[model samples]
Target: MIHSVGNACSSGEKRVRMPAVAGAFYPADADTLRETVVSFLSEASSAEADKEVQAVIVPHAGYVYSGSTASEAIKAIPSDAVYKRIFLLGPSHRAAFDGASVNNAFDSYATPLGQVKVDREVCEALKHADPVFTYVPEAHAREHCLEVQLPFLQVHLQHVPPIVPVIIGTQDLAKLRRIAQALQPYFTSDNLFVISSDFSHYPSYEDANRVDKATGEAIESGSLRKFLDALEKNARKGVPRLATSACGQSPIAVLLLLMEGRKDLQVRHLAYCNSGDAIYGDKDRVVGYHAFSIVKKAEADAFALTGEERAQLLQIARKSIDYELARKTDLPYDSTKMSPALQQHCGVFVTLHKGGKLRGCIGNLIGFLPLYRLVANMAKLAAFEDPRFYPVKESEMKDIDIEISVLSPLRKIQSIDEFQLGRHGIYIIKGEHRGTFLPQVAEETGWTKEEFLGHCARDKAGLAWNGWKDAELYVYEAIVFGEEK
Candidate 1:
């Protein structure tokens, strides 16, 4: 299903314009670049794409420094997104400029892969907002700020929506605020907002990590004032070039302001890397790249676990296991053991216990199994195949505990603000081993959300201490039940 829609030549075969930078900046060969892009996008999961994403912040450095990270963000984009226009904003790294300059080309932006159409309607609307918004091809022509992201978009979205590429050079907060505010009404799941800028450019890998982490935390918290304060603090100390390190600070500020109206802001860190992490490996001076998606959080499905329902689920798991193990036959439970409507959804987990100790837990994150069948199969696996314990001795059957979590399908969460700590269970898996605990697990363990995830990545997945960032994470709710106290 992955493909590059356009060819190396210009729009149609009627005319051709050569790649402006070619090998100097991006890959010269269309096929090589296509393959690289495919690999990157493939790494992102579309499971959450059914939920509309509000906006995304990605780095616009050369593909090598930021490509992989950027790919993660794009891949995370809900495949079902029906954006009509893409408003791309990036900080000007080229010659000094003032105001917002839109790329004034009738022709689509030509890439080795193909041309991405310009959204004339959006472009025209923006120009009408402020006189400073002028048509300037010179500003966007060789600008890697906006150009680099084009191919990534082309590779993923079937509909190549028109683009409004803006290069930010002036640091006038009022102007930037006005521009973002004006454009805010235009943003919807059907419309996309792209902000491009790298963080902590040319800092030592260690220092870049520290400063960038601060910036990222600030963004996640949705505190524009704090982010700006950090920049101001450094500037006040006569820290020359420190503000320059975060080149896209203005664009980020605009995004922060626009997102203010939205209460739900889950900024998922898709990928992050610097030159030091690249295969080419330049640790001495590194440019930090981060890709994140912001979206409005949909209200989670409301399911109050009635005492009757809890009792039914526990009995079902126990009987299902006993029937299979002892009677060597299928257990006949109520046809509505779990809601059929819920089964049609994805992301369910089953947990089994014996003598009040953990036994086996298994789940299909995307919700392939019906709620009832998922519980049945998982109960068996937890008891016999968990690998953590000897086969649940027949004698231990009386002491086993069973819990089933009928999870609400994961919606692509736009904002972390939507996440309720005690309401969601988290799972982090990468490579072979995986770590997961139900939502109640965190409450029981007295761990904060971050601490719980970190432990799951480290202790459960057997990954490095900070492995959560690179891990595949799925968050869900559990209809949990166990032996009555």
Candidate 2:
């Protein structure tokens, strides 16, 4: 049986929770802490900050080791957004107790940046909602997991909201689910959830890389069952000195439970690294860190081309390919006959196949030109400019298969479940390298979802076989049309 703990401090006196490791884990001085956090946020791409982020998974190791990786997720939150509360959850590293330990005894948590107020009302509500919630002062006295995240939140958010600090001490999934259920009403857009965790502790650099990649993929997959299966599998592999795949598995599991069945919410992998990569650490054995964000998709931002528009684009691609191979100077199309939809700008890809084998493929990811022009240009490029294949001769034009894929605007997804095999194509980007596979690739290769992602990560993006697990992954639906159709 679970029990509730914590003093109901309704008097509203600001009971302060002082920093436990201010100088050791991070800077002790206020200015230095602010400067260090600002530098880390600056390293992240500003474009990610524009997202409507709902939650983030960040590493909780000391600043010298995992700070940069944690910044990738923290910086992704738009500074201007307003939140009623922030739910900060982490696993207890110092104390062992049952269920969740809420720190309602403190009115505010103090760090170098400043003191952040605790949401006493929410804490009281949580206590009433579930028996698993209790005030365990010892559980948080020396815990570094939740403390490490406060400075980042203080610096990145334009307006700091009161936090519901939770220390997960129990590993029971049933109790965690009840806790999540209790919090579900408050898990709205007005609140943010931050799960603090570090991955693959005390393993060789290579082994950590391998194990962390699998763990990351499982988390991003958004299937709690899959994540647990992978976690158990990694534990059984017996990697030398590997303590755990993730330190905050329970907190993450709670988030996963909250996210299940919500198609609008998507998870994006922002950054990943191990302690071995840090200047102060060695490559022999290291701890791993990863950052990820859960964002909400705006339906209004996505655009879909009509059936007639798709047909016209297909015709344009086929005609362009035919003309290019014939050495003709002009494509055979009446510009006046094109509909308004064809005049719209959209990215397109033209693929050519001979005897059911890939002959050539080419396209642009950004929709800079009109649909017809983009398709025509890509068709010519696919036939002759593809470096992977020889230029198509006029004789082969009759036997060639032309296919056009009209794409929707690419939107970053939070989970692998967002990708529908044979329906939505995937795009992966990491640094300057990127790889894309059309929805049909899944159908042709008959690969499972994991295999499909593995191929794109390894073969196309030049990352490792499990690279997509940590790389930025986007999903887009395509309207595919073929000559036979």
Candidate 3:
């Protein structure tokens, strides 16, 4: 029969009985750890509520080494959740194990914050598979890989859920896959999957950034084979110094497999840095840490753009030239520059082209500026002030292809559920002012709608997203066109 492994806590006991890293790593005193954890959580950037997170990869080192990166991912987790369990998978740094070691102890793991019950049923299911798995307490004793994540979860989740912690110590890809496949039933929307890993080791800060970026690119591109190749190539560097990343390579493979069915599994890089960037720099030897999230897909037909609309935008660009030449004086391009009749109903597009290449493009989603006034104002700014591209030159004007996007009115939606990338341009309206643009805004640059919205939110709207909830939304059609100078 299954049973408790550690000493049971008495009614008079103030805390659960579990090992603490104490003075060796973070502050040993409970109050000190609490203050540090609370401070870190407070500094975290807020995440959007509409953004559904399915999986994440975080780093595991002392707070001084990788806490910031790990904290970013933890903060991004959906703040409101009631998942049945959390499956934390990490690589072993201390003892050796053949495949997976399920922590079968009955005692709850105590963190500086509180206790997380070990999910006995899930642990037993993974262990019952036979010779490939075992229940080992020794393997986890000195391992900080999984232990480091516990505090973050405690702080964010608030309500403690059962945990299935596995320390992977082998390079058996096949075994890892089989276990992952076997656990498929457990990875549902109601369950959260966490994979802990750190990037580059020993490479200079510059070299580490380059190396880690390659892995990040592969992860973002959703290429499992490429990720594996990166690891293998790093391993072949030499016998003494293997290029190991996210040490739990096998676990990552399984996560990728489970995430395959999802098309919108976006990889968000929350934070990245090598030991070199830390306050106390370590140029000679250092490990890299990164935090990332994967999101699920909610709709189909998300990224297609039509051609006729493309032509309409360019037409608007040409018209902008006249507006700019008319108002090139000291006055800024605000509402007062236009005639009374033209002030209230113009659709504007600020488009830029540099050295014959399309550059920065920004616009309104509705007819706030008159068609002519909007086109003219945006064209001038597009050419002269676009931050993405060098300013348009008098010499390059002949080669520049100016485009304008006159937008349709926005339709307020109840939720993100109504979003259509190629069809609906979204306007997120709140308070006195608002920001808007057509979905084609992203298509013009060939960026995915998700990528487009992220830039627009940060660059256009300047909204610090708490998550897409009941915010007012408007969708509009765009007539885009361009012409030769």
Candidate 4:
């Protein structure tokens, strides 16, 4: 759920960041600004895509020069779509720093369009997470890059969600990656990322086109090395009248870093032009503008079970554990009464926690038996056979909470980067040894992705902390549920 910034600053002094370039960059009047943005969007030739557009890289020059191109890119974010919040990532044109800055003081930012609320909660979260994120008031005070995009969003979107305005101030690549890591959680479909940048600044019209094309293609490649090399390669050519390839390169790098190794996204070049293309502008010196959309592929649930099915499985697990406690040799089940879903084969893990401490947990990586049978067997094994703890006592069952993890098939991961923390469980296996931690382990431990793998490799797999680098790594997701009480 989203909390409005108004409520956050209601008791405190209300602070609004008034637009710094409303009249100079875009229309000063709200109606004129609305008309200009709407016209540009309507004139965009880029067809609305079928896939979900998660992010956009657009130019942030004055409306007369880059407005059309920016509109072309913003169009990719469907007008009817709603987001939890929009993160406006732009370069710090006025101030420089080591990392990005989040708005800590502002309640909202005002444009000719209206006041766009700032997400205070998100800002606080980032600030507390790491030193890389902090309040640099000077960085945001008069920044025009993010300011210019507010109107386009207000006009095109049906409802403008609260924004988390971030100014990327670092030129250091490693710091950019750290900034990306901090922002990764919000880089999902529920949120939108607007990367404000202008390409090929102060170059001749012809040279701007040539340079911008290479740079845009590099961004489209979604390879960090290629993107950075393209910039370096462009500089090597010593194109006359060139100042910088992309003024917003820092923020763009942050976006590229966040997008690293993501295979499900398709980047499309929406529109391209330059200030030279503008009637009021000249060809001698031009700033190129390009709009690109990062679209996410459709996703389907890997596995799903009905509410009744989940209840039945839990009952089967509890009964199986009870039978084991009573020293029963066999578990009796009526196969004819079982649903088809229960008959499907899948790996399972059953965990027992007594008074919030792990008592016993055991699971199988491969399922040769039906799901119902697997759950029963795993439940019995977890309660009585886990090596880390003694068998669960029958009297303790009343206070023990049982959790079941039903897993999808294990997939051999090409890179450890593919193993998302808090989402996928990783299994590291060397020739004679192997170990795995469930997906929830990351949530429970609050470990970074690297730390998660290191622990699994060292402690769980009986290998070195960096042993996963050489060992074969596989990842899997689970539909985890626990007992109601």
lDDT of 1 by residue, 1-485 (tens): 22232223445533322345556456867898888889877765545563667788888877876888888778777655677678899887655777787764454667778777766655666777567677655666566777788888888877778787777777888787667655644554557889888887666777677667767777777667787887665445443234445688888887876654244455666667777898986776788887788876775335455676557656767777777668676564667555534334334566766555567776655433445566676777777777766767778777766767766534333333555678976666454445666787777689876787778778877888778776556566666566574
Candidate number with the higher lDDT (1 or 3): 1
- In order, the Cα lDDT scores of the candidates are 0.68, 0.83, 0.63, 0.83
Candidate 2 error regions (>4 Å): 1-13, 300-485
- Tell me the TM-score of model 2: 0.60
Q: Better model by TM-score, 1 or 4?
A: 4
Candidate 4 lDDT over residue span 1-485, tens digit each:
11121222232577878777777888888888888988999988767644577899989999999988998888888898878799999988888788889986888988767788888978887776568898887888777898888899998899899999999888898788678766765677768999999999898999999999999999989877788999999999999979999988988888876665355677888899999999898999999999999887575324578888898888889989888788787664667779977876566898888888898898876554678998998888898888888878889889988899998766566697788889898877665457899999999999999899999999998999999998878888899998998
Q: What digit string (tens of lDDT, one per residue) describes model 3 on residues 352-449?
A: 66565566676643333344455655676777676777765566656666666555433345566677787777665333224555656666667665
Residue 393 miss distance in model 1 (angstroms): 90
Residue 170 C-alpha lDDT in model 2: 82
Candidate 1 lDDT for residue 336: 51
Better of 3 and 4 by lDDT: 4
TM-score list, all predictions: 0.57, 0.60, 0.57, 0.64
Choose 1 or 2, whichever is better by TM-score.
Answer: 2
Shift of residue 311 alpha carbon in model 1, Å: 50
- Per-residue lDDT, model 4, residue 269, is 85
